[model samples]
Target: MLASVGEIVVVRDGSGPEILLVHGGAGPRTTWGALAPLADRWTLAYVHRRGYPPSPPPQQRQDFEVDARDLAPLLAGRPHVVAHSYGVLGTLIAAAAAPGSVRSLTLIEPPLNYLVPDDPEVARLERIGDAALTHGMDMDPAELREFLRVAGAPIGDGPLPAGVVAGVRRAHGGRPTSEARPQLEAIRDVGVPVLVASGDHSAALERICDSLADALGGKRSVHPGAGHFVAAAPGFAEQLETFLHKSVR
Candidate 1:
């Protein structure tokens, strides 16, 4: 039987502590479902960001300001948490918001404002960044998702899944100008046992993860075969298990 989203504190029953799993843009809990095999050794809870997946929500520029504190009420307390990409943005915001609740965190590739590379030696890079940033603060949801996907990074020829691309339309526009600076500040202030990693291939990913690890007193792991998706790398589960085992005490 599956555990109820609200039944577990922090999220679900992991081997060491609780793990709250948050997904990136246009993704669903199924995004993490692939990792369910890890559930045998660890309790995992996958969050759908409320209105995402099959739910309906307002189209507005929202902030990760609420973090897991929004999930806290449901989880009862903060447990060890893990977030990826943009999901890490809010997870970090939450940890900073309610330090008492979280035990430890493993954040892989949280996108900070600076990760958006500005120097694109190639014209395509420049164009990608320009289109992605689009005034640096628009309320257009599609543009926002598109920017994140292509900004500072190569636009892979791979076609984005229709469901994934369509998911952006569900969100309210891009980052709010007033909120961006402060949000960045909050992530900078998070002082806790944390792990930050990125793929070796991503310039911005490597740079930002390094900066975050340095600032937050975190361990940096550069997955050799991975890029932005470090958590999906081979042996990531074992690495995480080792980290969690040591961290639980």
Candidate 2:
């Protein structure tokens, strides 16, 4: 079935314990390809966050709080929540606001900068990200390709797909949300299971995942040879299934 929460679009499929899959800037369709295999075992709610296509554009510039508010009602019955990249920010906020609204959390390569703000590697990434946010679409072709590579496209030496470039451009305009540190304590207090996973490729992301795991008292997993797109990796579904079945707190 399909539903709309404010301007957000949610598509549901399968039948079992509810699992809300929130995609990052790439939109809900990005998760459809990688996570379709789980539909047999999970009643999945895939959210297309505001500003993404099919979801109406924001009335004004919206941040993570806007997303969290939109997601709260969907969390009814305490569904197991999984989010990737920027989607993780809103998921964390929603889980914190409604303390027991989430049965468990599986975050993959969430760019939670506040977790390790002082780390040098994170600082370097921050600089790169800041630059991209400021000049991504304006960047030269070569520069944009490098940016895409650093951002984890998992593509070969060929030209990037047009859709990928367009997605990045659309995402570059997003406003920054408030720091996530304040919500960490509340999320931890909720006492639900949390699993933080990241790819082994980026040093900064690894550190961020480590710190996020420590904050939530959650287990951590690293997908070999994977980058930001860890969900598309070969064993990702297996790992998620294992965690969901055996790691409930």
Query: Which candidate comes out best when scored by lDDT?
Result: 2
Q: Give stretches of model 1 more than 4 Å off.
A: 1-16, 54-59, 66-69, 115-161, 176-191
- The digit string of per-residue lDDT tens for model 2 on 72-152 reads 888887899999877888898888888687889999887677678678878766655555555657756665666567567
Per-prediction TM-score: 0.71, 0.89
CA shift at 194, candidate 1, in angstroms? 0.7
Instruction: Give lDDT tens digits, candidate 1, residues 18-111.
Output: 5777775535343454466777766676666645633334244434554344555533555667787656766766666566566677887665
**Candidate-wise lDDT, in order:** 0.55, 0.77
lDDT of 1 at 35: 65
Q: Where does model 2 exceed 4 Å of error?
A: 139-144, 154-160, 177-182, 247-249
Error of 2 at 115 (Å): 1.9
Clash list (residue pairs), candidate 2: none
Error of 1 at 88 (Å): 1.5
What is candidate 1's local distance difference test score?
A: 0.55
Show how many residue pairs clash in every candidate, following the order shown: 6, 0
